[model samples]
Target chain A: MTDRRGTDERLAAWLDGAMNPADAAAFEAEMAGNPALAEQAAAWRANDRQIADALAPLATEPIDPEWLAQMGLAESTAVAPAMPPAANDNPAWWQKRWVPVGGALAAGLALVLLVVGRPPEDPQDGGLSLALDSTPALQQAQLDDGRMIEPVLTARAADGRWCREYRIGDVAGLACREPQGWKVEAEVEAAPATKPDEIQLAGGTDNTGIAAANARLGTADPLGAADEAALIASKWGDR
Target chain B: MADPGPDSQAMREEIIAVLPRLRRFCRGLTGHAENGDDLMQSTVERALGRAELFEAGTRVDAWMFRIARNLHIDAIRSVGRRGTQVDIDEIAETRGEDGRETVENRSDLAAAQRALQALPEEQRSAFLLVVVEGLSYREAAEVLEVPVGTIMSRLARARARIDAVVGRSQGTGND
Candidate 1:
C-alpha cells in the first residue's frame, strides 16, 4: 500500500518534471509496463492542457493602462489622461490622485483634512491608542474619555508599518503605528445608522475614506479576526 | 529632477515585462477579471513602492508572484467576512471580448474556471503556479514559501480533484 501511494505521488512529480533524469526514466519504464498508470498520466496531461487553453485569454488580454500607470510605467502612446504625474517626491501622491476616482468626495475632503488638520500626536493621550493597539476587528472598547471605539481592520502598510482602521462615534479613520506614535492617516464622517440595532454589523458603514486609506497604504486585505487577535496579543510585532 | 539610476530603471523594465503573467496569475487567484486586475494593480504599486527591498540576482517574476499571492490570500480572508460573491455571468461576459468565441469555447473556459475555483485556495495556487504559469516546482515552492514536497502533494491532490470535476462534467453532458 505504501509503495502504491509512493508511486502515485511520483506520478505527479514526474508529470511536473520535478524528478531527476534517472527517476523520470525509471517512472517512464514503469509506466510502459502499466497501462492504467500511463492512461491516468495522459488524462492529467490533457486536463492541464484544457486549463491552460481556457486561461490563455487572461494572459493575452490587453494590459490595463491604469495598472501600468500605477506602477509609474505608463506607455507614451496609451491614452491615460488621468495618470498621476510620475512624482517620486511625494510618497502620498498616488493617494491624492487615485482615492478621489472612487467618487468619494467626503472621503477626499477627509484625506485633505488629515494632511493639514494637526501635527503628529501620540494617540495614547486620547486613551484611543490602547484600543487601537489591542482591539481586534468588530470588538468595541470604551476609551478613557468614555467614548466607544471599534477597530474595523488591521493590515501592514507597504512601508512595513502596522496600521488599523477604526471608528470613534460617527468618525472613521486609519492610523499607523509610527516610530513616534499612532499617526492618523485619514478620517471621514461615517453615515449615521437609522436603527440602533443596525450598528453592530461588521463595517456597517461603507466609509470610502477608510477604504481609500487602505488602498493608499497598499495593505493586503484586512487580516481576519483571529489574525488580528494574534497580532494584538503579540503586541503587534511577532507576526 | 535627477535620473533614478541604472538599477531602478532595470527593475522597472523587468516589472513591466512580467505584468502580463502577473495579471494572469492574479486572475487565476481572484477568479474574476476586474478583481484580478485590481489585485494586480495593488501588487504593482506595492512592488514599485518597495523596489529598493527587491534583492539583486533574484528572479523578478518570482518576487512579484510572491507579492501577488500574499495580497490574494489577504483579500480572500477579508472577502470571507464581507460575504461578497463573484458573479458567474460576468465571467462569461468578460470572455466574450473576442466576438468569435463560440459557445463551446466559452463553456470550456467557464468550466475550467469552475474546476479551478472548486479546489481550496492553496491547491488552486499550486496548480496555477506549476501548470498554468509554468514555474518550476522549486520556483513554485519558493513562491508559496513551502517545502518542495508540499508542492508535490498539493499538485497531486489538485490534479486528482480537477480530473474528477472535469470528468464528471463531461459525463453529465453525455448523459
Candidate 2:
C-alpha cells in the first residue's frame, strides 16, 4: 500500500474493471507483494456486491401505479406526430387497426344502452336532467339509458375497475363500472369551478378523485376518449 | 390537443413497462423508500406534463432518469435545504433498512445502504448511476451535468467510503 501511489484509486479502478492493462498489471504486482492491500481490494469488491444485493430487491417493489399510468400518458404525449408516409409507402398497419376498433366501439356503446338503465339525475334537482353536451371522448361516458354523461374525472382502480366522478346538473357523484353496471360508490356536493374531467388527464390538486384514484388505481390515466368509447362499446355488446 | 395518434398506445405501454427500473433508480438515490417513491411520482407527473419535450428515437430511460434527478434536486431546494440535498442525519436515524431482514443473510448489503445514505447527495447520484443503474462513466457525467473527471472522482470517493463502512461493520476494515 505504501509502495503503490494512488493505491485506493488503483484498487477501485481494478474493482470496476476500468484499469488499463499496464496499470492493471502493476496493480496486481503491488497486490501480490502486499497481501493486506489484496484483502482490502477484495473487501471493496464484496462491498459493491453487498450494495447491489441489498438494493436489487427494490427492483421488485411495485412502482406507484398512478405514477406508472401517468408516465404512460406523458410518454405518449411526448412522441411527435408521425411523418406522412413516403410516396411509395402505404399507411402504417396500426393506423388501419384503429378504424375497426373505433367502429366496433361505437356500435358497442349503442347496444349497451338498451339494457342499461339511465343514470340517476342530480340529487339536488329531485331528478332534473342535467344539460350536458357530449364533450370530447375521454371525459364523456355514455350510460345505458341513451344519455351522455361526463365525469369530472375518470380513472382505473387497482382492482381493475374503471371509476369516474360524474356531475349531473350540479350534483356530483362517484361511480365505478362493474361487470353488472355502473355502481355508485360515493356521492358529494359538486365542488365549484373544478372540472375534474378536463384537467389535462395527468392530474391536479382540485381533483380529489384523481388523488383518490391515485390511491386506488395508482394514478393510471384513463384511455383517450375514442379508445375508451370503443372499449365500452365492445364490452357492452359483449355483455 | 394532440389526439393519441397511432404510436401513443405503444408508447404508453412502453412507459408502463419501464416503471420498475424508474422505481429502482429513485430508491437508489433517495435511500428512503417513501421519499424515493414520492420523487418517482413527481418525476412521472412532470414528465407526463412535459411529454412533448421528449425527443423521439432517443433513450427514454436516460430522459426519465434525468427528470428524476432534476426533480429530486428541485424538491431539496424547495424545502430550503442548502448544501446537501438529502438529510444524512435523518437517513442514519431511520436506517433500519426499510424494516426488512437482510438479503439472504447478507448483512453487508444493509451496511452498504447505510454507507450509501451517508454519502453526499451528488456523489451518491454519480455512484448509483454508474454502479447500480449500470450507466457508463461518460453517460453518468452527462446525466449529472458534471465533467467526467468529477464523476470519476465522486465514484472513487464513494466506493472508498462504502468499502470502509462495510468493512468496519463486518469487523474486517483494517487488515
Please report the candidate that would top TM-score against the real structure. Answer: 1
Residue A40 lDDT in model 2? 84
Query: TM-score of model 1's chain A, to 2 decimals?
Result: 0.45
Q: List the candidates' TM-scores in order.
A: 0.54, 0.50
Instruction: Kindly give the stretch of ten consecutive residues in candidate 2 chain A with the minimal lDDT sum.
Output: A106-115
Native-referenced DockQ of model 1: 0.23
**Candidate 2 local Cα displacement, residue A128, angstroms:** 54
Rate residue A179 of model 1 by lDDT: 60
Error of 2 at B56 (Å): 4.3
Report the Cα lDDT for candidate 2.
Answer: 0.56
lDDT of all predictions: 0.70, 0.56
lDDT of 1 by residue, A31-114 (tens): 999999999999999999999898876664555556566457754223222323322221121233223232333232322223
